[model samples]
Target: MKYLKPWRSDGGGLLHLTILLSLAGLRLDLDLDLCLLLPPPTLLRDELLLGCDPTSPAYALSPYPAPGGWGRADQLHPKGREADPAAPPEGQLLREVRALGVPFIPRTRVDAWLVHRVAAGDADGAHGLLGAAAASSAGGVGAGVDGGSQAAPGGGGDPRASPSSPLAARQEEKAPAEQTARVPDADGRASEENEVLRERHEAVDHSSQHEENEQRVSAQEEKSLQQKNEDENKTADKPDWEAEKTTESRNERHLNGTDTSFSMEDLFQLLSSSQPENSVEGISLGDIPALPGSSNDGMNSSAHYNVNFSQAISHDVNLHEAMLLCPDNTFRRDPVVRTSQPQEPFLQLNSHTTNAEQSLPVANLTAFLPFVDNQMRNLTSEDFLHDLNINIFDEINLMSLATGDLDAMEVSQLFQEPDSDSGLSLNSSHNSTSITKSNTSHSICEEGATGYSSDPESLPHHNLEGAVGGNYPAPMGHRSDSGFCGDLAFQHVFHNHTYHLEPRALESNSESFSWPEKPEKMSRYLSDTERNLSRDERRAKALRIPFSVDEIVRMPVDSFNSMLSRHYLTDLQVSLIRDIRRRGKNKVAAQNCRRRKMDIILNLEEDVCNLQAKKETLKRERAQCNKAINIMKQKLHHLYHDVFSRLRDDEGRPVNPNQYALQYSHDGSVLIVPKELVTSGHKKENRKRKREGIEDGFH
Candidate 1:
């Protein structure tokens, strides 16, 4: 036997002892009933199967073959054998075993136990057993017997031979039996060895069964947790579903309850019924039932109900019918006048008639009197008709003047007064009363001439005076010394026809008597501004205002105030002047505002049209660009295929189109690269870009 070196006194010593026994040709099979003798199947299998002896053919092919060549005989003898220089020291090996957290038995103790068993007559055909056990112990818990034996040439162990593999148990049982058969062991010792092996196998089986049970329990727990989460999600969604259902129900109820259709007549009725007294008589909005799901707040609920009711009523009513149902006095209607026979051409002048009336030609006077009398009679009945008749008479008078039947000089002479000094003073109460009575009697003649009964006593004297004064200008050019009837006449005329008279007529009539021919037609020729100025002119004339409406409106505030101060004006006249100025300014402002609004509207419309055109142009351009892009894409696709099909590798063989692709660089260069390489490069670039974008965002 080879003497073991002091360095090989640990696990290496056992390995050295096993080799010595093998060289001595001993078949001592020690049936030691110690757990240490039956090494763990995992360790035994690793040493016997995975380990390569220097004598084995597998060792010669191994990448890490032993330094010196050794045959089967040499392996059994191993002259001048020493521990492998590559093996760890005893202290390092112990530390490694401790790091692995495995139970470690000292080799000296194991060897001493083996010697004790041999001395006790236990070494029966157990040489092979001892060698296998010693080899396993020397290898340590998971150490390889040889440097390159732990893994295949590929540098990894076989997965099928792993310790945890299901077939490992069967392999473990077979390995022990094979080792036992290698030596001629007694049947009793063999049975005891088999029993010990059986006990160890059962222990491994029990541990595996425990791990499977734990896995099953974990799977059940995960299933329960998932089911609980799903139930929670369902419960959370239930309220939302119920709320939606309620909303739908309310909508259905609202639709079913309300009426939407209406007619024109109903609209009319609704409008007529809107009067304060009648509003409550119709169906009250509050009487309508509230809709389902509506809040029960006080004012809000009532307001909502009223709004709904009003909308429903408006839809069911007509405008015309509503108007018809309105009170008769709500709107004015004209009375129907019956046409009577034409009156006789006759003079029925009263004794109170002025000399101006007496001098007129009978035929001409008769033609004028009846019409004037009719107009005066209708004044109280319908002012519109009275004004219409006046306009008509003015037209007739103009035609008469054109025909030379009525002269302007003749008309002016009528207001001259036959006896200037003898004529009654306008200030005389008796003369004024008489003049008013004569005018009333002249107008009343329509009834007398038409053979109708007259009532001079019942006729209102003031109405007759106002009728004469308002309708016609008093005789002008009356000596200024002859009372203030001109002012009175102007006041009345201004009150009635202020907006109608021409400016020339107003100025001329104010100073002297001058009847312009076709004066009524002059109004038609006036521009809109002139018409507006004329209206202010009339108002100024009525109030006896000294300044023109235009100057009042156009003048600066300081100028206007100075003008107001210069004039001796009553509060009424001053108020009237200010009103005229305000009205004139408002009118001009309104006109300018309307004009600006029209310009703005036109500008907006033009902009809208321009924008629409621009939109259409852009759309067309985009379409053309897209079409060009599509054409380019098609050409590029075709070109790519053509180029790829003709591409050749370094060996002059046609490159596979599917395996290679064309890539464009930022510098506008195109290159052919492997498809997989391009795909992986693109993935990396995308990830880098994404990471950079995220970082930029944080910054």
Candidate 2:
């Protein structure tokens, strides 16, 4: 199936630009779009598939001629049909060929042997096919001859003989004769027919083998083609592959006139070069309009830029200049007084007014009004817009922020006017010195009466202790006076407390006027009752310790019971005491346990030593016992030999009546006799022998 298809890409923008450039000879504005439409060369395509298998055709053949306009054949060419049986080579005549046509001429020749070799996929098949195709296309007559053997035969004419003849006349004369020679002679014709039949049979067999090879080759190629189709279909079905295809198609459509192949750098260079050559034609800094007043043209007034406070731009000629020059008078209008009747009010000053005087407190509400209105509108309509108000005072307490916890007198000096020497002067002429002396006298008098020691330097200690006095029990002899702050004094104190003063107040006050250095003396103005609790008040007072031993002990138990009932003890506490023994004698138990362990260690050591000693004693005793037993056995054997010798008369046998006696000890030691003697002897004799055995064994 030879199908021809043409692929054309429409060049909308790029084509127009390229055509314009070609016609006009302009060197400007060439982007990748022009580059993209240039068709690929044939060498590129040929190189792409030069090694590709003909049997496995992965791509369709190109319909266009190769770049050089060369006629190109693909590896994936369609198979040829079989030739007629009347043809000399039968299946060997692969396909009818016609070129410079004549009767009995072979079609475009492809070596039958070579084609068979290629079909069979012989080792040299590709080389053979290339050689044959090259030879046949080169118009070699040798390639057309059967088996390429015509040039070798004796019947061959000149090697370069032309096909159209001087031979034509000779062939014409012989044609008639050749026809007449076919008239039958029965035996001769039969023999010629037999030889022709035999040659035809050999050619038929060759053709048959070639057909078989072709069929096998075709089957292989067909199988490969089917597999390739299946693989392509599978790839097309895959999700990523389909996505890639769609993306590629979309890109092809989008960048129809533009090339997507250009890199960022290349595109940038192209864009920069494509820009207009002249600065005038291009956008430049100089072309930008200057600021309103900066322009030299008097007609181009700055009026449009003169914005009033209400945010509206003014077009009044002088107003714009005045706004720039006199910003203070732009928004504030002069108050105008209107007279009721035609009568004019008396002039306040001599008549010296001018044209400029008529324009007083120039009122222009246009500059910032729009901005304010916009802010208000934004707050009203948009949820995102918030009108946030922060009261800075609430974040920090002003009084505590200003007047820190310090003695007022010490703080007052920090805000006071220093002497010429820059040191606090003790001169009584100064109101500050007099005030300090009064406070000192007052403090001393109070301390003397209350039997409390007062120190000028201990004021800070007093203040800290006093702040804690109401919570702590009264100490020593001092007691709080209930009438200390009477109604009038309380009112003064209340007013003082209400009118919060800052430490910096004195500084500001000093800047306004001089301040007394001794602020404490001002407190001395109070009555003795009001001044009852001085700095030494706590020291002068008595405190009865509320916490008794019983209370302390009861508190822990109560707290413990409450905690246990409420399950209030934290995990840390539980872990700490979980393993504590409730009734153990702590110190004694630990000491005794340590002692007992030491005792056990000593006992174990002694026991181990005793066991080793016992083992040694047993071994020594065993050796001694063996020696004694051996000696006793030897004595018994000697006694037996002497007795036997006495009984026998120079013979080793017993001749007289044999008697054996065994003596016993006086202490009634029982004896053991040997089994032979015990069974044979009488009862009395056996008893006597047992007693004697005991005595003899002991010896």
Candidate 3:
């Protein structure tokens, strides 16, 4: 029996060729659309049983030309040898042959050479059924032959003597004559002859000349085909550079007409040119067209149109000027004149018109027309100055009173003006006296004169006598009378309360007016810091707490206790103080807890977001792992089928999976046993273990 030489020196001999052919057959079977259209298990089982069974009819007759003859005449009786009349049956002979371990010819090499010859002879028909069946069954038949060969010595018998050798050609020429001379046996046992005779013939014809010639021809054909395919692939892969360049040039030409760059000056010029000719800068009041409702019959229509047009033109001009002057480009229009009294109708159609009709003003006309240039020119500087001073004085008085409380010193400082030698200073003293008297009378009436004595006996014989009589005394200084008037005015402004002025207004006035250098005596008249206090603070102040309201509420427990010990406070005072402290702490704690709760909620939201992202990532990973597992399972299934299909019994028959099952041992060796036997053996083992456990329990 010839043993399979898997590690052959000459390019891995017949065993390697068998494996390659088996792999090629598997690839072709897998590629068939029939596998997708049919159930996978059923299709795979049919293909494996049909293709891998060496005894199948498809593989019974070797595709290669036998050296002896087509019917094995020479193998049965070599050189006119007589046949035995009492020869055993074909099955018995096969069993006997296998038992004896006789070597056979290397049919794998012969089949491969036959396929090559057929392919060379008729290239167009090379893919026919005969070629396909031989390729598919090559591995299984080779494995059987290898097993038989291993049972006998010199299995392959020769290194050379391939099918393409001249010796094989000579045998082919004599095959026809031998076939004619040979007679068929009635029992059909001729085909059952031992393959030992063919092996002997192959061993005798081990020559190398014809094999070398065939190898050289086949190598030249393969090299030329490969080189041609590579050249074709290179041409197909190359890009058309010339066409691409032409396309790019065409696109460039299309874009050449448009300019993409522009300066800021160009944008400004374009915007200016886009403006209308009748813009506000070019149009005047005279240019405005009269409305269709205006009449030429009376001066009233003309006057009304003039008023409306002037108002419109003035509004447009003001907006245009503001846009050009202001950095923010915002327009601040003048306030419109509003009147409480009713006016005559623009067109008094009749003298008997009702008062309601006469009172209705024109829809689009201004309530008062703008003053003419002549009227404005008639206004003197003194009149303007006087009006300006009165407005300033009113604003100061209002601002001082807005806080409803003002200290005596703050009020005095507010009205004090800077020393200047202008003629306006002379009249300031006389005007200041009247202003102080009026403001003092108003403050006394409104605020109940708590800081001053209204009695004539307490009044001082001075210009500010009515203003700060008992509350504040006028400061004595070398400053002008304007300074003294300012001091008197401020005393009346603040009265006996604390007042806060706008910081901006205070700063502007401070630059012009200087405060009295000696204001120490004024401090006694100013109210205590308890002014504008909350009810609790006022009550605490009235009770005369030694510590301030802030210290009482915010001090630590030990400090508060020490403060109480030092003060000798009543029980009522102590209880009230403790209540104030507790309320303040609770308010602060509530604010902190609200902030902390919001932070915790935000952190939990962030955590939820992160966990959701992680869940998505895990879902994606699980999907990928499942896909990989399915792919691996498919490959493992194919590998299992391939291995099982290669298994054979001692009689050289393919093992049937229905009767026998393949199992793995603990040592990792594969063992084939009948299905029923495996199940019975497992059952017996389980029963024995159970019985042993019971006996151990009893013991």
Question: Number of clashing residue pairs in every model?
Answer: 17, 24, 13
Error of 1 at 398 (Å): 23
lDDT of 1 by residue, 1-699 (tens): 001110111122223222211111111001000101212222221121112232432212111112221111111121112222222333443344335332222222122222222233444311222333322221211122122222222222212222432222333445455544543222112222222222222222222223333233223322332233332333335554353343234333432332332222232243234332222111222111112122432112223323332233221111111111111112111111000000000000111112222222222222223322332243323222233233323322322221122232332222222221111122123223323434243222221111111111111111112121222321211112111221222121112111122333233222211112233633443334434445456445433355767788998889888877765443334555676778778999999999999999999999999999999999999999999999999999999889988988899999888899999999999899999999999999999999999999999
Q: After aligning candidate 2 to the native by TM-score, how far in Å is the CA of 622 from where it should be?
A: 3.2
In model 3, state the lDDT of residue 148. Answer: 19
Positional deviation of residue 244's Cα in model 2 after best superposition, in angstroms? 69
- Top TM-score: which candidate number? 1
Q: What is the C-alpha RMSD of each candidate to the true structure, in Å?
A: 67.9, 51.1, 65.1
Better of 1 and 2 by TM-score: 1
| Deviating ranges (above 4 Å) for candidate 3 | 1-550, 565-576, 657-659, 675-699
Q: Report the C-alpha lDDT of model 3 over 596-654, residue by residue, as the tens digit.
A: 99999999999999999999999999999999999999998887778779999999898
TM-score of each: 0.27, 0.15, 0.22
Q: Which stretches of candidate 2 lie over 4 Å from their true place?
A: 1-588, 648-678, 682-699
lDDT score for candidate 2 against the true structure:
0.25
Report the C-alpha lDDT of model 2 over 454-483, residue by residue, as the tens digit. 221122112211211222211111111211
Report model 2's TM-score to 2 decimal places: 0.15
**Native-structure RMSD, model 1:** 67.9
